[model samples]
Target chain A: MPEPIDFYFDFSSPYSYVAANLIDALADRHIRSVTWRPILLGPVFEVSGNRPLNAQPMKGDYMRHDVPRLCRRHGIPFAWPEPFPIATVAAARAVYALWDQDAEQAIRFAKAVFRAYFANGRNIGETDGVLAVAADEGIDAAALGQAIQDPAIKARTKAAVDHAIKLKVCGAPFFLVDEEPFWGVDRLPLMDEWMARGGW
Target chain B: MPEPIDFYFDFSSPYSYVAANLIDALADRHIRSVTWRPILLGPVFEVSGNRPLNAQPMKGDYMRHDVPRLCRRHGIPFAWPEPFPIATVAAARAVYALWDQDAEQAIRFAKAVFRAYFANGRNIGETDGVLAVAADEGIDAAALGQAIQDPAIKARTKAAVDHAIKLKVCGAPFFLVDEEPFWGVDRLPLMDEWMARGGW
Candidate 1:
């Protein structure tokens, strides 16, 4: 059987939010599933010397205009969150914690967190926001709170980020299919073609 | 009549090479013409605090892999040119020179320059290389050489770069349609849709 597509993302990324909303349907059409792996961009940025999309000068301005237009094109809801690019450690850890218990529920929670931050403008940078999104997903908020603080979950999230860095995952919404890397939400169509044609 | 699509590109960019090969056709599909404006990214990068894609850490590696994959997908010939990301001033100035004399030949010269550097590993950073490409395009090499050195042509090139900076064109393969901005070759699909639907 073909392996599931590896989907890596962070909560602080606007493009990731768009890719997250679309990857599943693309995968489903090809009779494939996605393994949603949450990661922190902090360490990845440190290694790559890359800054958040909203932090650069002209590129930041371009992204601000481009992201909304992209979201509109895809019929995805998006708004620039306040205090943009908040720490995503809390959100990443929560996903890792839930992942250990229920993989499907973890994906649902991740989706909720993305929608909360990007669509609803809720900051998912802090523990409170993470738990709030979790609760809304019908996840046990207190258990999630404890799990986020659990050293094991924190280490798992860190390890995942380290793995991403090792794989040179420089951007969020990066994907690995058949060990081929595809980055950016804009790559979704190419990735779809790659899956359909089995590489060229 | 629809305003011509403003295609801003630099010779040093790989994505620009790919986009340059495809954009005219995309424009033709929408019954639009393209104004191929060659601008140096040096000043724009200075304003944006941006570095070349190959100068970064992991992102550079990703670009190296991505560019070839994209070329293959589009059936465009590509090879990582020796001394990649060379100074494009001479090439830009030559384009301006050819443009004033013959618009169609100027575009043919630009496309040849892109093909020269990207497909055949030719170095287009020097005046001689630019002249050779111009000559290959059946342009008068000696006349083109004199024009490239003309103070008026130099100023025109510089002014074009300034105008791009003013428009916040922070990257190559950037497009401005109906005064709306789209950046990156990945944005080509979106640009097509925007032109088709007349914006959303």
Candidate 2:
């Protein structure tokens, strides 16, 4: 058995999507597996005073240049999703719906949300967007939509965000392998190495 | 001649030194060289709300794991400087003094300071340690010491810090490659590729 690496992610972050793309390979190694703990990144930024990269000219410049190039390196096409930082509330609710019934399905929806925002520039805040992805996952879209409105699911997702803050997560795609948190996607190589040394 | 890339650096920044080590080789084919812009990361942080990696536990852990490994890749030894975020006011002043008289000497001394503080746990903030590095670059220790205390040099360094704040550099080791600012060392490959393709 391998250590379950907990990943704190969000659809609003391009880095999270990039991290999602490589997560399967990470899990397949048998050295570690990902526990996708989707959190709202907005609160993380609020307390930490971090704005979106698009908000700062310097950081924005790096994002436009570096992120697409990074995606290109991974042989993935990329673009900024429209309605940046789309309301992840609905997406979060759907994630909770699949938390137990179907884990792979949950991850699929998560990836879909990320791709819609970062790669396709779609508005994930729209119910239709979330439902379309849910339908594609073979889940009952209407039921999923209703479940998304549940207070318990809302609380669950918010608690994850609170837990992320307690864990000191300041960025998206934060990975914790054996309680050691790696914050940025750029640190993946090191995370891979550390997991390997841990008998991955 | 390649247009000179402005490298905004802070003496206490390990990433800046690591990036600087490769700046030359990466820019070999470019028409512009590098113009070392000594800036204070502290002021940049004051405006942007980014603290030292060590100050932010989660981000700090990521840096500790990722950077030492990158240093190893660059064939540089690794260690976290003791008393992290050692004052660079004095060190910055010394570099400003030597900036015009000897850009190469100034760069060497700045790098030595980074290595000493960030790799060897030595305090470049103090007079003796920085002077020791200056002597290694064949500079007069006494003259350099006097330069450190010069009001003009100190004021110039202050201005540099303020300038970085205005430029919106939120972190250490930001660079401007052909007028496009890249905030982290990880952005180098893309910036280089752009320069290769005339993206600059």
Complex DockQ per candidate: 0.89, 0.31
Off by over 4 Å in 1: none
lDDT of each: 0.91, 0.77
Show pairs that collide, candidate 1. Answer: none
lDDT, candidate 2, A1-200, per-residue tens = 86788888877778888888988787677555668888887888776656777766455655766677678878666887666756676787788878788887787778877776777767788778888877876789998988888888788878888988997887888888787677778767667776777522
Q: Candidate 2 docking: what grade?
A: acceptable
lDDT of model 1 at position A63: 87
Candidate 2: deviation at residue B14, Å?
Answer: 3.2
- Measured with C-alpha atoms, the lDDT of residue A47 in candidate 2 is 66
RMSD of each: 0.9, 3.8
lDDT, residue B64, candidate 2: 71
Assess every candidate by TM-score.
Answer: 0.98, 0.81
lDDT of 1 by residue, B1-200 (tens): 78899999999999999999899889999988888899988899899888888989999999999999999999999999999889999999998888766888889899999999999988999999999998888889999899889999999999999999999998898999999998999989989989999999
lDDT of 1 by residue, A43-129 (tens): 888988888878789999998888888889889988889978889999989888888689999999999999999999998889999
Q: What pairs collide in candidate 2?
A: A31-A200, A81-A117, A81-A121, A82-A121, B1-B31, B2-B31, B2-B32, B3-B31, B3-B32
